[model samples]
Target: MAKITASVYTSHVPAIGAAIDLGKTQEPYWQPLFAGYDFSKEWEKAQKPDVVFLVFNDHATAFSLDMIPTFAIGTAAEYQPADEGWGPRPVPAVHGHPALAAHIAQSVIQDDFDLTIVNKMDVDHGLTVPLSLMFGQPPQSDYRWPCKVIPFAVNVVQYPVPSGNRCFQLGKAIRKAIESFDEDLNVQIWGTGGMSHQLQGPRAGLINKEWDNRFLDRLIAEPAELAKVPHIEYVREAGSEGIELVMWLIARGAMADVAGGPAPKVVYRFFHVPASNTAVGHLILENQPA
Candidate 1:
């Protein structure tokens, strides 16, 4: 059966994608931010999984306010990069694992998670930025991404988004679904988005480092309890956009420790700020053997 080997979490800041595409990563302002992910790039090369089930929120590129699905999963054979205003990032098209994606959709829906099965859609920076962070810039000769990517988009843009606990529970269902697959594949689930920083209103450019670090701490050690966190706290403490962190709970709930197995090893943890006025948080947890 297929096994979920690890869960990766990070903030999918669009500006970071621009930094890479515009050849500005080495600029002093962006160097520190890129440096934080240096370990992640190296780690990816050594521990490349066959597939990555990435969770992110589509930023008005794929789904607008007119039609927003709380949860959507990409089941297409491949996805084109979305052209968000200033042309699409010069990134490779994302290939999907249709067979496994279909299986997961079947299993998760049977488990009572109402997921919108997306047969086709353009992937924006929310999905591509995380890929660029983990795998780095694709070479000029060949620009394909390192692994097959399965996009799982959550609705954090509009009101009435799923609660942290709900996402956590969904993660449990996803793990169960993946484990039941017959293929002997190594899979990784990635949750992208959030640290803090609101885009509009009077309190724009908010960065609660204290609160963000506390979130990372609780997420690592007390996920079940952390799942109980209410949405208001995320808004008051970490800013409205901070609610994106709940998506991380989805990845966390899929870890072995959450399901009465061995605790995962914390391979890497990073926190940085002010990337397009947002705090960037990242983590990697590798599941341990029974």
Candidate 2:
């Protein structure tokens, strides 16, 4: 049966993607931020998974004010990069695992978590930026992401977004769904976005390094307790966009400890500030072999 071998968490900032694409990563301002991920890229190369179940929020790219699903899963064979006001990034198209995705949708919905199954949609930096960070840029001759991806988008833009507790529970259901699948595949669940930075009004460019680090510590040692954090705290303490941190619970929920399996090994952990207007955080946790 399919298994979730690991879970990755990171911030998906569009400027980071642009820096990499523009070959500006070596610049003094951006060097440290990219340097922090050097270990993650090497670690990912050493232990690659067949598919990545990426969890992120749509920054008003796919869903607008007119339509918003609290949770959506992509079951399409392919997804294209979106043009979010600025031109689209020159990234490889994302290949999706339709069979596995469809199965997950069915199982998750049966588990009572309502999800909108999307067959076609343009993926924004919220999705693509994370892939770029992990897999790096594909060769110019053949541009394609290294592994199949199943995009799971949460509605963080809307006011009544899913709570941290709800996201955590849903992640457990996802873990159950993956284990019940018949295929024997290696999978990684990635939670992207937020370390704490707000990008709006007078509060723009706010960074709470202390709060972000504390969050990382709790997320590593006591996610169950951390999952209890309410949305208002994330907004008031971390900043408005900081509410995006709730998505991390979904990936953390799929970890081994939450499933009564072995404790997860923290393979890699990183935190950096001022990646664009957001604080960047990255983690790689692998399930200890049973």
Best model per TM-score: 1
Tens-digit lDDT track of model 2 for 1-290: 99998999999998998998799999999999988888888888887788999999887778898999999999999998998998888998899999999999999999999999999988999999999888888898877887899999999887899999999999999999888889989999999999898889788888999999999999889999999999899988899999999999999999888978878998988888888888999998999987
Worst 10 residues of 1 by lDDT: 137-146
RMSD for each of the candidates:
0.7, 0.9
Q: Rate the local accuracy (lDDT) of all candidates.
A: 0.94, 0.91
Note the residue pairs that clash in candidate 1.
Answer: none
In Å, residue 145's CA in model 2 sits off its true spot by 0.7
